[model samples]
Target: MNITIYDVAREAGVSMATVSRVVNGNPNVKPVTRKKVLEVIDRLGYRPNAVARGLASKKTTTVGVIIPDISNIFYAELARGIEDIATMYKYNIILSNSDQNAEKEIHLIHTMLGKQVDGLVFMGGQISQEHIEEFEHSSVPVVLASAIEPTGKIPSVNIDYRQAAADAVAMLTDAGHTDIAFVASPLKDTINQHVLSGYYEALEAAGIEKKDELVIEGDYTYDSGIEAWSRLQELSSPPTAVFVNNDEMAVGVIHGAQDNGVHIPDELEVISFDSSRLALMVRPQLTSVVQPLYDIGAVAMRLLTKYMNKEKVETPIVVLPHHIEKRGSTK
Candidate 1:
C-alpha cells in the first residue's frame, strides 16, 4: 500500500493540512512542527501523489526552461541557480537547448507550451519580433533569463550590458590606452549591439575617434578569439589593450598573443566580460565584467513563479548589478 499524507500526519500527531503545508515547502508552519512532520514523512516513506494533487489544484507544478547552450559554463551556472529555486518551490523543470537558433527556439517554445508547463524561463542572445509574438501569445507566463526584449514588454532578468561594456572599456581608457580593441560577439545579438555601443561611447568620451577595424566580430568562442588576434596583428597599428566579449575568447586572445612572444598587461592589456572560472584558469588571469549569472537565472525563475502564483510584482523588468573584477590581465 502507498503511504499517504494521512498516515504521515497521524504519525506526526498533526492535521493533514499541516502535513500538506510541510510537504509543499510552505514557510508558515512552525519549525518544530515542520521537522516532526518531515521526520514522520521520512519514516513512513510518504509520497505525495503529484498527479492527483495537480488534478485537484489545477496545476502541473512544472515549468519549462529554454537555454542557449547547456554545455557552456556560462549557461550551466545560470541553469544551476534556476534549478535550485525551482526545487524549493516544488516545481519540476523541462529544460531544452536552442543552440541560439531562431527556428529551433520557436519550435521549443511551442513544444513546451504544448506540455502545458505552468511557466517558462527563456535564455537566448536575440529576441526577434516573431519570438515576441509567440511569447505574448503563450497561455502561461514567460520570463526571459539573461535575455532582452527591445520593447520591454516581456519580463526579464539581466544586467546592464551597455553600462558594463562601457565600464570595461573605460578601465582600459583610464590606463591611457588610446587604441583599445574590442573582440565582440555576433553583431546581430542585441546584447552585443549594446556592448559595441558602449565601446564607441567610451572611446568618444575619452576623445578618441572610433576605428572600424578595431572592432573585430567574434563567434564567442576560443578559436574566434585566436582568429581575432591574428586579424588585429595585420592592422596598420594594432591596439594596445583589448576588451573581449566573453572569457573563452579572451583566453584565446591571450594565448594567441603569448604564442607570438607578447607579454600580457605590460605589452598588451586584455579585459573580457563574464568573470567565470575560466578567467582564473589562464596564465595571466582575465580582468572581466562580473555578470551575476546564477542570480539572473534564480531571479528569472522566481519572477516566473510570482507570475504563475498571481503574486504582486512591483518590478517586472529586473536589471541586476554588474561590476569589473580586476585581475592580472589589466594594468
Candidate 2:
C-alpha cells in the first residue's frame, strides 16, 4: 500500500498542513505536533518526496513568481509555501516583486516569458484586461494565489474573500455593535471590492444602516490603518467596533485606539482579516479571519506542476476555506 501524507496525518490526528510543516521544517508548528507528526512519518514510512521520486529523470526547470511585496508578512508566508513546493518538484523559482502595479506586472510577465520559465505564479490585487491578455499569450502555465480572476480562464487558489469579510462584520454585529466601522484596503482592488460588498451585505442583513464615514480607505499599511482610525475618531458618532482588512493595519488600529485611552474589546472592539503571525505578535492579540496563506501558495504551485507535466486537472479555480479566530481584540 502506498503511504501518503494524508494517511500519516489521519493516523496522527493532525492536519496535512501540520505534516507538511514538519517535513519542511517550518518553525511555526507546535513542538508536540511536530513530534507526533515525525513519529507518524517514521512508523508509516511516508515520504513527501513522491514528486521527486517519480521525476527522477526530469529536468530541473524554473517557475517565475511575481509578488506584490515580499516585505508584507502575508506575502512572505505565501512565498515560503511556493518555494518549498517548487523545491520538492525540482523547480527553481525566479522571484520578482510587481508592487501590485499594472505596468510592472505586465513587464514582469513578459520578462519571465523571455526567460522561458516552465510556469508562472502571480499574486496581485486586481486582474486587469492586460493581465488576461498576457496570460492568454504566455506559452507557460500560469496560476494565481490570493488573486481573483473574474473570467475563470486562469487557474487560481484563494479563499472566499466575500464570505470571510461578511463573517467578520457579522461577528461584530452579533456582539451588538451597530456602529461598526471598516478600515479597508484600496477599493480598486477586486479583493477589497468583494470585502466591501460583504461588509454591506452583513450590514444589510442585520438591518443596520451603513454609514459612509465609517468606511475608511487604507493602503494596507500600519500607518494607513492608524490614519483610518484617527479619521473615525473625529466623527460625531465614532464606531464602537472596527473591521480592518489585514493584520498589520488591524494592529495599527488597535494601537491607535490605545493611544487615545480606549480599551480594546471594551471601548473599541476590533476584527481584522489575514490572521498572519503578526496577528498574535500584537498586544491584546487580534481576533481575525484566518487565511491559510501558505496553503494557497502551496496549492497554486501544485496546480502549476500539474499543468507543466500535462496531468489531468479537475478544477481551474479553487477556493480554500477561511474562518474567524477570536482573540483578545473582540468580545
TM-score list, all predictions: 0.86, 0.82
Alpha carbon lDDT of each predicted model: 0.93, 0.91
Q: In model 2, which regions exceed 4 Å deviation? A: 1-60
The digit string of per-residue lDDT tens for model 2 on 1-331 reads 8888789989999887788778877899999989989998999999676334224324337899999999999999999999999999988899999998999999999998776678999999999998998998888899999998789899999999999999999998998989999999999999999999999999999999988999999999999988998999999999999999999999999999999999998899999999999999998999999999999999999999999999999998999999999999987
Question: RMSD for each model, in Å, please?
Answer: 5.0, 13.1
- Which digits, one per residue and each the tens of the lDDT, describe model 1 over residues 268-330? 999999998899899889999999989999999999999999999999999999999999999
Instruction: Tell me the spans in candidate 1 whose CA falls farther than 4 Å from its real position.
Output: 1-56
Pairs that collide in candidate 2 are none
User: By summed lDDT, which 10 consecutive residues of candidate 1 come out lowest?
Assistant: 49-58
- Which candidate leads the pack in TM-score? 1
